[model samples]
Target: NAGVTQTPKFRVLKTGQSMTLLCAQDMNHEYMYWYRQDPGMGLRLIHYSVGEGTTAKGEVPDGYNVSRLKKQNFLLGLESAAPSQTSVYFCASTEAGRAKNIQYFGAGTRLSVL
Candidate 1:
């Protein structure tokens, strides 16, 4: 109810299975982001959208796809699950002109692929 929230707080998937992770914000922010955190690797941006109906690839977009069909929602989809894709995923959002570093984040989604 404060800023952002991600659905399916935890998930487990088998190799080759497909799933979608959803991020929803109540702040009505124009910029939204998706990131993955790995052991000792820090967080890496997977994808982002500047505004509704617009999306861009980030540093680690190879195994992921994203969409922002509505201003309040962003979706990340994995076509085929893999062990390498397992990580803690976070969703963030902020005002268009606000400092990118100052973002509101979801509680995070834990995913494991076996």
Candidate 2:
């Protein structure tokens, strides 16, 4: 089973252009998250869902939105992309509220905004 997969492995967007990144997992995990990794700031959470049909804002939710409509999928949408948003995006999943569980990440999507 594919643990997690991200669409459009690489993308280049002009300022203000919008795009959606799709993530899918087959692990039947209950917690899914979207995070952005910059050069040095480490991974910052953008949005997360505890379960299917539930979504919540995260540490760096600005300029991004997320949705979890199916148990195995999470989608991130950038309505107005900016240069500052040019970073690697990773989608991760873990067992819900299982304190002993660690997150498993996707290969990541590289986005560049000019």
Candidate 3:
């Protein structure tokens, strides 16, 4: 099974353009997360879900939204993309409880905004 998958590995957007990034996992994980990686900084969480149909805001949630409609899928949306939002987006998942400490990440999606 595909451990974790991210769609549209690369994208270029103009200011104010909106886009949705998709994340899917076949591991049946109980936790899912969205993170952004920028130059010279550790990955920052954008949004996360504890389980299907449940979501929460993360450290950098502004200008972004997330939904987990199914146990294997998580979606991140940017309503008005900005240059500041351009970064490598990563999706990760892990098992519940004790196993949660270990997360598997998808190949990041690179986004550039002009």
The sequence of per-residue lDDT tens digits that candidate 2 reaches over residues 91-113 is 99999774999899999999999
For model 1, how does the per-residue alpha-carbon lDDT over 51-104 read when each residue is reduced to its tens digit?
999999999998899999999999999999999999999999988973645788
Could you give me the TM-score of model 3 versus the true structure? 0.96
Worst 10 residues of 1 by lDDT: 94-103
TM-score of 2: 0.96
Q: Quote each prediction's TM-score.
A: 0.95, 0.96, 0.96
Off by over 4 Å in 2: none
Q: Write the per-residue lDDT of candidate 3 for residues 42-97, one digit (tens) a residue.
A: 89999999999999999999999999999999999999999999899999999889
**When superposed on Cα atoms, how far off is each prediction in RMSD?**
1.4, 0.8, 1.0
Clashes of each: 0, 0, 0
Query: Candidate 1's C-alpha lDDT?
Result: 0.94
Candidate 2 residue 6 C-alpha distance from true site, Å: 0.8
Q: Comparing candidate 1 with candidate 3, which one achieves the higher lDDT?
A: 3
Candidate 1 C-alpha error for residue 4, in Å:
0.3
- CA lDDT scores, all candidates in order: 0.94, 0.96, 0.95
